[model samples]
Target: MRDLPARLRELLLETGYTLDGVRERLGTVAATALAREETTPALRATRDGDPLGTLIRLWWLGAPVEAPDWLPVDPLVEAGLLAVQDGLVSAKVHLQPWETGGYVVSDRKVRPGDPALREDHVVGAGGASANLAQLVSRRPAGRVLDLGTGCGVQVLHLAERAREIVATDVNRRALRMARLSWALSGIDGVDARQGSLFEPVEGERFDLVVSNPPFVISPRGRFTYRESGFEADGFCHDLVRLAPRFLSQGGTCQLLANWLHVEGEDWRDRVGGWLAGTGCDGWVVQRDVQDPAEYAELWLRDAAEQGTPRYRELYDDWLGWFEAMKVTGIGFGWITLHDSGSLDPVVRVEELGQRVELPVGGYVDEVLASVGVAHRLSDEELLGARLVLAEGVVEERTGPPGAEDPSRIVLRQTRGLCRTARVGTVEAALAGVCDGDYPLGPLLAAIAELTDQDAVDLRVRAPEALRPLIAEGFFHISTA
Candidate 1:
């Protein structure tokens, strides 16, 4: 395996075997088809004399092909990573270039009808992988931990700046695959372990922790990568509760999770209650919601268990489980917890239905940092702090047609969460005038004079008003 990295790198560089190179060789139509897991188009394009083309055709698309005598197949076969059975060199694992640089190696991409799919599947770059990677702070840290590190996708991102990376998974196969991916990416020094949750790091702590845990709310664990084999989102709930304990002071943990929305039960309270006694400041951003039927069907199709003659039986069983639990919907979101060491922890649970930009990690770090600052500051100190509107926050004014005094004024975010905040005339004016130049107290005093309102009253209420706006990324409190 060690020699394979260097050999692979040499061959790839010699052949220009990159994501862009493959796409260019295959063209748009075939590239798109290959992306959809259809090998026919890619097969037609890669039968040329190029070693890169042959490698892609045989390894990535999983299409059987005759190996040319020019390539070094013996080493890969001896390493147990490939097998040239039936005159066709087949990759034992899937290898594809990351959209960025480098490559990700994981279990072969399963087609819709592949009956040989294993139960303990280690997937790569699924939706939650992208979400968790984007939610986590990329800032340099002393050490980082990735729990449930399937394919070690998050470990690759954490390796950018983390001094040392530790990745743990219940599936040992995933840990092995994770190490393979690390080697494939031309990086090293990840402490990979086989264990569930924090078992491997019992007494250890870290500067950052990240996870895209097995959070699918499954009645049974039919698959290893998605289903946790836990009842009613227990995996997610427990991980959220347990992650904060292994963080150093002021350290942060981020994860992608799903929560059940039971009948007549508020989701915020259900998920929020999980953070009790954790002594960590927490924020939950709910991005998607699916009803019982929609949720069941999505995972069913995802596991490739749909459209079979037995589908009706499994479908009915899933619906029955949901009905028994009175689960109305499933909520999908990102969670960020910070060990700020505050006496009174701050917890914010919100749902942002609007589409946001990818990699909102910057906004998350900002929000958590601002929340810590808010907790540390006195009311007087908070009122005296200078603030400014965040970038991409624009003010919009609208009202009934022909009305001179606009009855509605909204602050809309063009990035991050893409949220809109409705503000009255006073708050709107305050947001407009804030330029990180004037402190909140003085600014409100100036507004007091213009509006004939009492300065003392404004000062008292201003801190409370700006508190949420700051935490929600509507405004920025200048620490400089």
Candidate 2:
């Protein structure tokens, strides 16, 4: 078992089975079609008898083919990666080529026409996985924890920067496949453990922690990968509450989560309440909202049960549960907690539903830091602080193009969250000239002089108005 991963890696690299190689081989049409779970185009593309083609057929498409002479069939079968029947070979698990040179090992994806997924089925990298990877800060860490590390995708992302990584999962099958993935990816000494959530890592602290946990709000916990056995969104709430205990001071924890929007509650307060006593600066961004029916149908289709005989029964039951629980809607988003060790931790809960830039980890890091800075600074300190307009900020004036003074002035960001702020003439003037050269008090005083307004009143009102812009990454306050 130990030697097989090396041999398999050698074989895969020799056949050009990396992510770019496979995508190039499949071409644009077939590759795009395959992403939509339409297999016919990819099946036609991989009919050739070459090594890469044969690999795609057997492992990627999950199709059976005659054993090729060039490949070492015996070692693969011995590794339990493949099975042979009547002179044909087929993949027992999905060996997917992931980012750069990594491989993710998991159960074969259960497509629309495939058999129902097993209860312990381990899924490969999906949208949520990618989102968590993008959300995590890339700063080097002494130790990292990947909670619920199914197939170990986050481990691959953490390997380059972390000195040590401990991956935990409740499902033994997921831990087994994750070990294989780490071995095949050439990442050694990943401390893999089997336990639910923080149970496996109690009394241990880490510099960073990330989880794409079983956050699906479901009535039944049939699927270990997506559903927690806890009722409603309790699993997510519990995970949030327990995270700060395992985090070293100045460490960070980021995860993808779902929270219910009950009939009588504002989701912001409900989710914010999870951070009350954690002693960490927390940020929750609600990216999407789904009503009861849409949420149920989405997960139902996820298990390949959309067209099954029990489809209606499962669907009805899911909706019934939602209705009985008073769940008006479900909100899906990213929750980031930074263990800043502040005596008074700041927590912000807001919604950003528009499209934003990718690889937002740096943006997240900056936002959390800025939140702490903004929260700690007194009004006098804010006025004395030098500030600069952030990069990618563009100013626009609207409402009658030829008018002497535009009726509306907007400041928009081209990067990060792509947020916008509407400001009055004084704030607009401040934005145009804040280059971190002078303190905000002097700058606003100059703006007051130019706009013919009361300088003292301007100084008092400007700091509060600009606070949101600083939190949203539209401006940078110089701490130096």
Candidate 3:
């Protein structure tokens, strides 16, 4: 498999097979179907004998194809990427293309009619992988670590941004597959190590760390890629609790995780306990919450073992385990941390279920910077700073017909977190006119003068009113 990556790259280049090229040849519907792991539409579309078409059907659809003239298919056989049997060639591994113009290599999925995959089988870029990738921090760094780099999906992106990278995983097969993925993409020098959690990189710190860990909270699960083989939410808890030690100053760690939402307990404080003693500025944005049954069923389907007695047994075991643990629900989301050298570090927790734009990585940077800045300021100092409304922010007003002024005022942001804030008229006017031209003191003074309100009163209330807005990215402190 050493030269297989280069050989495959050469084959794809020779045949001009790219993400866009495949979509153009396969059409949108077939391409969409192929993305969902369905082969029928792609198989129907790729009936032609072209070299690229043959290769796509062979690798993506799990179908055998005759070798085309220009593809140089012998390298695939020599590299064990494909096997020739009964005069038809079939792929031994799946080479799925990502949005970054590179192919991610892994064991093929066990489709409905296909044989069951091994217990330790590594998956390609699945939904969770894509989610974490899209939300990965794009800010360049000196060194990066991809924790639990299954198939090296995040490592591919990190390699492009960092000077060096170390990709670690508990499963040796996952590390092997990651090496293959890096080679096939013509990416080199990624240090692939096999060890659980941070054991491989002990006593080492990195400028950036990214992971989509095996965070499924199940009762003694069997799979390696999704299940951590720990008690409920234990893996995620330990990961977060130990992450700050691995981050360099101002370095960021971004990962996806799940935490138990225990009955009669605030979920925020339950997760906040992980932040204790870490000293890093941590933020958890819970994107979704589900009851124990919904969470169990979702993972059961993900395992492709539904509607069977085995599935029922596993589901019941999960229910009994959660019940004994007093777990009523589960919260799933991204947890981001920035290493800060502060005696009193800050951690902000929020819930945002509404859809936001892709590449949510930039928001992590903003949140860390905002927390650092917002938490350090005194009220007088905050009042003296000049700020402006964030870009793409607009005010919307709604009320009954013929109303003089809309009863509700909403400030909607179309960038970053894409949050909408409801505010009173005073807050609305202040946020609307904060053009970076003046400090908050003068601005409130003028607003109070116009509204027949006491100038001293608004100034006294300004810090409490505006501090949250700035911290949440409703406005930005102007350096201009």
* lDDT by candidate, in order shown: 0.83, 0.91, 0.84
Which window of 10 residues has the lowest lDDT sum in candidate 1?
368-377
TM-score of each model, in listed order: 0.94, 0.98, 0.95
RMSD of 3: 2.0
lDDT of 2 by residue, 1-480 (tens): 568898888889899999998999999999999988998999999888889999999888899999999878888898788999999999999998997488999999889978989899999887898899999997999899999999999999999999999999999999999999988899999999999989999999999999999999988799999999898999999999999999998999999999999998999989999988899999999999999999999998889999999999999999999999899999999999999888999998989988889888866889898887877788898899899998999999998867899999999998888888898887778788888899988888888888898999988898788887777777898756
Reference-based lDDT, residue 10, model 2: 86
RMSD of each: 2.1, 1.1, 2.0
Write down the worst ten-residue block by lDDT for model 3. Answer: 109-118
Question: lDDT tens string, model 1, 313-340?
Answer: 8788999999999999999998888898
Task: Give the lowest summed-lDDT range of ten residues in model 2.
Answer: 471-480
Query: Rank order by TM-score, top first?
Result: 2, 3, 1
**Better TM-score candidate (1, 3):** 3
Task: Indicate the TM-score of model 1.
Answer: 0.94
Candidate 1, 291: how far from true, in Å? 1.4
Q: Give per-residue CA lDDT, model 3, range 1-480, as digits (tens).
A: 456577778877677677777888899898788667687888888888777788778777778887665555677788677888877788888887777777888887666545555788888887888889878778889889999999999977777789999999998988888888888777899988899999999999999899999999988868899999988898999999998889988888889999999988999998888876788888888999999999999887776767655778888999999999899899999998888777778888889998887788756677678776787788898889998888888889999999887899998988778888888777898877899999988888888988899988888887887778788788888888
